[model samples]
Target: MRKLIGCGLVVALAGMLACGVGTEDGPGLQLAFARQPLDAPCPELPGEPGSAPVLDAVELTLLRADGTVHFRKRVSPGSDGKVRVGGIAAGEDLTLEVRGLVSGQVAWYGSAAPVNIRQGVDTTVGIFLAAVGDVSCAARPLQAPRAFLAAAGLPGGRVLLAGGVDRLQADGCGPGCDAWQATAAVDMYDPATGIIYPVARLHTPRALASATLMPDGRVLVVGGVRQLGLQAGSGMFLQVAPGDVLASFEVYLPGPDVWIEKTMPQGMVLHSASLLPDGRVLLAGGGTAPDEEHASNFAYLYDPGLGSAGEVVKVTSAMATRRLGHAAVVTAAGKVLLIGGAIYPTAPPLEEFTPSAEGGVFLEKLSSGLPANLMFAGAAIIPLRPDEVFVAGGRVYDGQVLQPPVTGNSRLIRRISSDDAEWQEGPALASPRWLAGMVTAGRELVLAGGFGDEQLTPSREIEVFDPQGELAAAGQTSVERAGHAAVPLVGGQVLLAGGLGPQDVLRSAELFTPAALAGESEQ
Candidate 1:
């Protein structure tokens, strides 16, 4: 086990719930959870004052490292919703999954993997078991309204929100807006404790950048603009300008919470950064000039295993084409699949990239059954199984409008390996969306607001796409949100932070909990 969760009884103090309920004998574990309300002062310094989480019991499951079930039981928690279990086998690497229950349904879930037990020692495991499928507000919003910011989940259930525009300045925003400025400000949110802390600022201001959590636990950031807000030309089109893009990348060290910046040979924006199986980050396919007007076929690899001393390696061969607003994912075969994107006005074909054994050539055009001319740039891809994923929603080319129409179509790609792959049809979305906020909650794919059919307006409809079932309406938010940061709290609960709302940059926030659907197992 790398680290053990600190076990303790989180006693209620001024509405704050404790982690575990009690202690047990002979290599025991004390487990507890924290929950959020529909409306809470999450960032209020003195204390997290809000309504209580509704949990009646906790279902506990203990397993060996090899997937063998060691112990399983459902016990009623104390007033704080905690339970303690003892008599676990000592010296065994184990896994623990805890579920919070309300009215006998699975509402919340969390787990600690590869845990070890020592004789007569107690393990304290604290988890955040947030309510599922509920929309609530988080208090003390981002110091200011932000749009196009990047957020990533930190170790220990915290979230890091970095670099975005604080406001749409006089330069104007989309539609009638001209330009917006980016902020270097950064913050961290701890869902377990319900607190947001002001952290170290970025060395350079950025927006629409890529942030990836490295294997060593530090966050690696790259590619974004500082002062250039995407301008809507002719009052309907939007794209990032080139000169304002940042060429450097930064790393967020956990303990000090400080960002260490490093320079890259070339600058890129609207690119896809994929963390490889070997602890390296492969950046592929983005616009390099004229708001991506001149797309470049460039690729860079960064090995972050060396901590702050890591380096970014440039690739020898260029990509299949210049692609902007693209999406990439590490495939089951370990190849980097650079999916649908636009080479300016043209949507390029799906290209598979292999850095390890491709003879210095990374990009190889692969075939998918998706519409030949469909340009689903910046589409949402959700993992269904280890070898399967579903790609959804992006702007498609249409001659009628300056900007192509937003799509509600989703194509399922089953990639067992490099040679074996196929694209399956619909499970189409109820509403068409581009740049939508998406989250994979166990088997459920929750797609929140984004740019909808009306161009500048945001989509308030929230839909749940289940591959095992059907696409259904979960709920809707009062505010129209898109280009926002969606951070995962304890047990896959999502915290939606600031983003653009029609004509204004918003400071408002929402806490979303997925529905604990029946028959869903531990995530």
Candidate 2:
């Protein structure tokens, strides 16, 4: 393969030739190139390639018998989806190499059959462009058994999975034998290489933490439980002592591969963080302790560029309600929407936070709330639009029930804007889910692996919702999970990692690739 530099096609002709038809002295060879049809299957390659990548440009190089470059030309496809290259020596055995560029990156490449260019004849080559990248699920995780971990998308199409429980000997620890312990292990997964390797470990072990990718490419990991305890009951081990909440947070700098620890105003768990428009992060409502009785009203602001060493500033503007297991998202209008969670009876189910002058912020309860007291619902920002969010299935609290009643089917809501905001109910989920993971994949919202049904069981089913269309079944994970981390990756893929599985915590992971969209033709 020949590598060429510069943005445009670099043309190098050994000698000047007339643009007219072939002559005895200098015969001109014309070559025409066209892409395969969109419905055509991608050609198999050694590595996975993107499916039906739109070819932005093409480069062709002619080589002599001895493998020396004789001529080269880069040309953009014409209206007919073909590129024509002329002025070549005829009646000679020449090797033709072609490369297809998608967004300036070499995505497809192939060599034409050795050709003996005959005088006064045009040669046509049909190049089939194959797709790149993996479109299949990953079989396992990089680390051991883990649950309630966090994942963030990095700049270079890599994913960072960090801090969760790593199960130890299941039966040796007595009644709590099945109980898993938290881990500080961190792993970096490169989709290009299909490798998940260890990075830096957190200063403290954490599970159920929130990892938000900042605009600067660093990840802010905040608030989770540190330890979990269980007791034997009714011939089965049950969680008797919940883990302690963690006030300390950490920052992971991908460039330096380092972890920096910082402290929040108070310990918290089951919280969520949103990346603000100004590059700072809003760490919102979570329980001050592990139990719902200790749910907190406190929220914090983390400025990555503030203080000589940076710091997490506690926001003095307390939320009207205490929230734990809530979901938060930054709207396009530069406002933060705090959604369903455990709140005091008097507290509203929905609220919005607006940043003010002098580095302060304020929260106002949205006039509209969930149809019911929903918590742990999956939330995501729809693509190609700002200030629009889609929130779905969550557990509904019934005062008399010790365990919140999980719904088998739940309503979905769309928030159009913060100013004069109205929560409009959309379609219902295909199945009821809570603690599910949601991410925007292209223009669609993908919900994966959450607790569902009245029994609050883990699920492996994946559902995709098209804003302009209806909710449709997509794919499934290898294992049923709840509280897992799902992150949208480049190239329209989603990475889902550790969460609580049917029988215990899960260390397994999977990747989901939605089917190709219509009108996606190869260039």
Candidate 3:
């Protein structure tokens, strides 16, 4: 009987060891996670006067039943909206404490509610901030001729930024039009320092113009109005030059400071221009006729290598509906996907443009059952996965001329070309806005500055959406803005160019990193 008891005890001990129970009876918590963004900072909304305190540093601790710590970590805000904590135990209760948070200047911070963990569970903690009075300089005024360094480039080659509006209004930048003027200055930003230096000035005044980075390394500056007024109808209209939409285009080469004029096969305005993988340039649909030309189905293809001798070829008129103020992006499949923009008054509007084998073909490719509500200035299209296109955050078409601008929780992320042939809502932004800049960086979708009709105010807030279509990370920009340009650079960073603010055209720019999305997970 004693021998049988001994054998049973040995078997039980073996079973416990296999189950990861140490003989010493130490804590059973095990830590594991995918990646951690240690340097990325999460942005906090600016505190109001005497409002509350803001937390600067967050510390996370894993504890046992006896209050003994298994692990601990410290985190801070990164340029991108991420605060990652990697290597968390697979199953352990965690307590988070926020310290060094600045409430005005006083280091007033708080702790978060305790979090319970389960095996293979991923979790997050929220830390609230208190506000105090702020005395530092507000966000700098964003101006024209804005430039950012390009990380990806050919060897021995340099990137340059030219032909944006100049700072004509210096009424102390930050929400509210003080002064506005056209810009003619050209500059270049060094990737090493993130600083822009004066290069040479251009003789042209181009505002709201489209600039394409050509394969030959020169920038192709296309049609933009050179005007001096705030009203939509009053400025000198460049689109109607010489009694027709301006057919004139120019290219700026760096060897020497020069702007060489080139003739467009067709004069057009507000069109979408992109560089094909073959080094050819495709200029598609815009207000092509003359003054106030709405949407045109016409498209033109330009080959720079063919030089002045080559004729600009006209592609087929294939759009089901005319469109403008829309976004056109080159998909990973080498096809151009034109997302939500204003459609003409014609029936069955809203279409997509894809390059056909013959030339270019614009066809209606969205699901009929999907929401066809008119989404104008607010729509942004980005790729979620290689085979999937994600469309999110835009105003719905009210079927009337946009007056007083559209507003609110209209947050919806639709998935295209997935297993489902339709759009499924993902997540919404903190606020509803129009004309905000959208781009994907580090497998995350970022929504930046835009205008909200309710406040009629521009926001510098920036938010990051996860790859899994989950909650958005907390972060914001130094300025609120929209109508600005957000382009992806090679090194996985984005260059936010000129956009209109409430008061003035933004002359300033900011860089965003993806550090705030950092986290730990259980295996």
The lDDT of each candidate is 0.64, 0.62, 0.46
Model 2's C-alpha root-mean-square deviation from the true structure amounts to: 12.1
Candidate 3 residues lying further than 4 Å off, grouped into runs, are 1-160, 167-181, 228-245, 255-258, 288-293, 308-312, 345-350, 356-358, 372-384, 403-421, 454-456, 471-473, 516-523
What's the CA error at residue 457 for candidate 2, in Å?
2.8
Winner on TM-score between 1 and 2 is 1
C-alpha lDDT (0 to 100) for residue 414 of candidate 2: 52
For candidate 1, write residues 1-523 as lDDT tens digits. Answer: 1211111123111111122423433555455444344422223123243444556666666678666778766767655444555545565666556666777777655554445566655455444444446565543367667888988887665778899887565655454555878889887765544445678999999988988888777898897887664544222244455677788899889897788888888787778888888888888767643233456688988877555558777887778777766677777666787766645344445677776733246655554665422333333345456666666776644322334344445677666354646777756677777777776665567778877763456777787767663677878754788888876554456778778776677776666766753235433
Tell me how many residue pairs clash in candidate 3. Answer: 38
TM-score of each: 0.81, 0.69, 0.60
Worst 10 residues of 1 by lDDT: 7-16
The lDDT, on a scale of 0 to 1, for candidate 1 is: 0.64
Could you say which candidate leads in lDDT? Answer: 1
